[model samples]
Target chain A: MIILGVDPGLTRCGVGVVEAGASRRLSFIHVDVVRSDPHESQDLRLLKIYRGLCTKLDEFIPDAVSIERVFAQANRNTVLGTAQAAGVAMLAAAQRGIPVALHTPTEAKLAITGNGQAQKIQVERMVTRILNLNTMPTPADAADALALAICHALRPSGALQGGEREQHLTQAQRQWAEATRKANRGGNMLHRGM
Target chain B: MIILGVDPGLTRCGVGVVEAGASRRLSFIHVDVVRSDPHESQDLRLLKIYRGLCTKLDEFIPDAVSIERVFAQANRNTVLGTAQAAGVAMLAAAQRGIPVALHTPTEAKLAITGNGQAQKIQVERMVTRILNLNTMPTPADAADALALAICHALRPSGALQGGEREQHLTQAQRQWAEATRKANRGGNMLHRGM
Candidate 1:
């Protein structure tokens, strides 16, 4: 199954596409950033981000999209921009009929580093190791996007396939299970998108 | 010129289109709501809104689009949804080449009721009076949408043309000036967005 991870922001958005095999082995497919100038009008900036994601979706055609969900208590300007960018990412995915999931910051950090409050560099190192890359992704946002995709792919409930009927999966576990089922379906490529 | 005002929220997005004569006469052209169910996933809800507004813009083809800029200090859930909805609204306008203007909530209230902190009923009553409508627009969001269009139309700097340029026009004043000039050129219906 293919997963596209999105780290959304107005000034710079990071995106990564990765393929996970039936054996759960992962391979990096693509990584890039979409940037909008800070001095541009809000309309132009938003359109750039929206159009960039739409183009990426058309190019990569990932089975599922994983987006970062930000906390609202951050610096107001950053949070507002991030939220809007996230909306555009979700819009692009939904318009194309791709299944989408949101991973909170803590959920992502916890899944990747086994610690909710792990530092950025630590998370980046883990993403590099998991993807089996010799050099880390250039920008931090790009590596973060890779981490989100890995979190979606390898999280516990999804990983523990044969152990069904637990009836007590954590929220994260439930998300992983549902997301895995949805992506694993991976409908025919010839008849994709609305 | 025709102005389409947007009150951005995922659950209930309000839209109002008004015709403002060079004589400064205001007439209601259209008023409606775009709604999304809360129980649905965020992507689906946002896509519904984005599609609905795109349909509205295509139908109305207004000369300009006006949007409400929300403050970040509001409830986290509501604020996040509002910001994303606002981004979608802007994207619709930008995609169609329509000039877009952002109005603060306080600016809308003050423009309509002469008080930034005016009560909802007060603003609704004033919108009814100004538009010469037989009754107030239903739902406070609809009324607020009308007020945003009116704020974009009748604000101080845009309305105070040919008046001496003070040594220092406030930032809002400058924006009103630029937005008015761009909207006023008001190219033929064939070409439009900013």
Candidate 2:
């Protein structure tokens, strides 16, 4: 199964796509950064990010997407931007019907470096070792994203299977039923008033 | 200036547009809900949100966009969905070059009801009174979004003035300059190797 991992940020988003084979071996397929145009308005910057994300999705076409979940942080602005990036990643995956799984930073770090509070350099070193890369991944963000993908690959529940999609469809159906009921009730009321 | 408020969610997004006059009097221009088909993929849901937002923008042509900043809560899944909704809203505003501002729930509640912990009913009542509505806003989410827009308007910082585009441009220029410098340095290294 091919899994795409994303480290989301407003200015720069790091994406790493990995293909997992038998015996949990993960192979790197692609890695890159999606950047927002700094010269554009904040709205335009977001658009740039969205477009960049779409391009990445089209290029990688991973079976599943794994992204870092927003952690509780003191900087509200930073958190808001991070959340926006994560949202874009999630939406991109969801739009394609690719199941998305969220991994916390600690979970990824622990899975990669065997330590929850591992430093960036340590995580990078372990990521290189695990993925058997020729050189250290440029930009710490990319390395972090790769680590997230590897972490998901190591998890028992990480692989994209058919059962998960079925569950999602079932849940969506229930929600649709509820919304339809509400809409019918509103329509009935309007007709009665008329 | 006209400020558009958005309360984003997975199923329904509440939108309200209010025109802020010089005397601080507010006029409601539009209020409605943007919804998505439950059976759609996550990407389609985001697209639905984007299209809906664009329609709203085209219809109202507001000067600024104000939205609730997603707060980290107990349910990671719910927070993720809220963040995605927030992203769609921000992206929609960014695409239009409209300045966007984010307000916390407590901040919005305090601005509308004079208390941070005010109940939803109290907030709805205050919103109705403040906007002189014919009736209380349906679906408290819409009322909350309106309250957020009002809070942003009344803020001393003048939240509606656009900022992201200019900063992005400056940053992009700086990055370009840095890249040029790096290329020059790399040329020197190549000359030494030759």
Candidate 3:
């Protein structure tokens, strides 16, 4: 299955597309940042995001769209913009009838690196290695988007490993397991507006 | 000029349409609420908001949309949803090429009842009287939406009264005046992402 991962933002949003390859391996298809001009009207800024996401949705036609959940404790100033950007992403995917998944940043980190508190550099490094890319996904935002896609792909519904591994989980893995469970359940969770 | 006032939310969004008459009088055209199912998926819930706003935009075709500027101090649990709802409203207006205005709840109250700290009941009373309605607008959300429209009607861009009132503004009024000035100055202010 193909996945589109979005790191939603107002000034610069990250978008990454990945497709599952043979033996459950993942390959990167596209990655980039969608930037909205701050000089433009707020409405126009939102339109830029909405249109950009729609274009990507039409082009990729991903089986599922994954995004980082907007946490309440994020930078207070940017949280709203981030939420709005996520709204555009969700709207685009929903309009096209695509499934959407939201992963908390930590859940995404754990899925990719088996650690919830992994730093940006560590996550970026792992994303490059997992996708078998020669270089890192630039600007960090794009890499974060890729991480979200990876998180979704590793969910129980996306791969058998995730389902079987749930049975042998450690006590500390319980939280991560619950997180993936909510995501794999696919839209059963409440709308946290991300 | 016609104005569409939006009190944005995830569960229940209030929308009101009003037009300006001679001597700066305001008359109500319509008022209603758009509600989303909490049991629905996040994407579907957001789609409900997007579609509802699009329908209202098509039906009203207002010259401008007036929405309450989302405040950070709102209920933590729902702030993200409120912001997303606002994003949808902005997208619909911008896509239709209509100008969008964001007013603080205080700004709306100040416009209607001449006090920024006025209570909800006071604002509702003023809206009913100003719109020449025999009965109060059902649901405080609908009343608040009308109050937003009334606020836009009395703004500097919406009416001459707003321009002249700037001369006698209070200290608190000065800040709001500057805020609107920034919004009208076309994205001159820092992007707050709301």
List where candidate 1 sits over 4 angstroms from the true fold.
Answer: A158-194, B158-194
Chain B TM-score for the candidates in order: 0.82, 0.78, 0.85
Models 1 onward score TM values of 0.84, 0.64, 0.88
**Preferred candidate (lDDT higher): 1 or 2:** 1
Candidate 3 residue lDDT tens string, B1-194: 89999999988899999999787788889999999998887789989988998999899899989987775446667877888899899998999899998887877877777777789999999999999999999898898888898888877542323676677765545555665665445332223432
What is the Cα-based lDDT of residue A41 in candidate 1?
78
Worst lDDT 10-window in candidate 1 chain B: B185-194
Q: Largest lDDT belongs to which candidate?
A: 3
Model 2 DockQ vs. reference: 0.18
TM-score of chain A of each: 0.81, 0.78, 0.86
TM-score ranking, high to low: 3, 1, 2
User: Taking the tens digit of each residue's C-alpha lDDT, what string does model 2 give over B1-194?
Assistant: 98889987767889988888977888877788888875665556776887788899889898888887665442444554566677788787876778887666666766676666779898889888888899988787788778877876655342223355325333323333333334334332111111
| Model 3 Cα shift for residue A77 (angstroms) | 1.1
C-alpha lDDT of candidate 1 relative to the true structure: 0.80
Query: Cα lDDT for residue B169, model 1?
Result: 59
TM-score, cand. 2 vs. native: 0.64
Best by DockQ, which number? 3
User: Alpha-carbon error at B65 in model 1, in Å?
Assistant: 0.8
lDDT of 3 by residue, A3-90 (tens): 9999999999999999986766999999989999976877899999889889888999999999888855477767778888998899
DockQ (C-alpha based) per candidate is 0.32, 0.18, 0.49
Deviation from native of the Cα of residue B178 in model 3, angstroms: 7.1
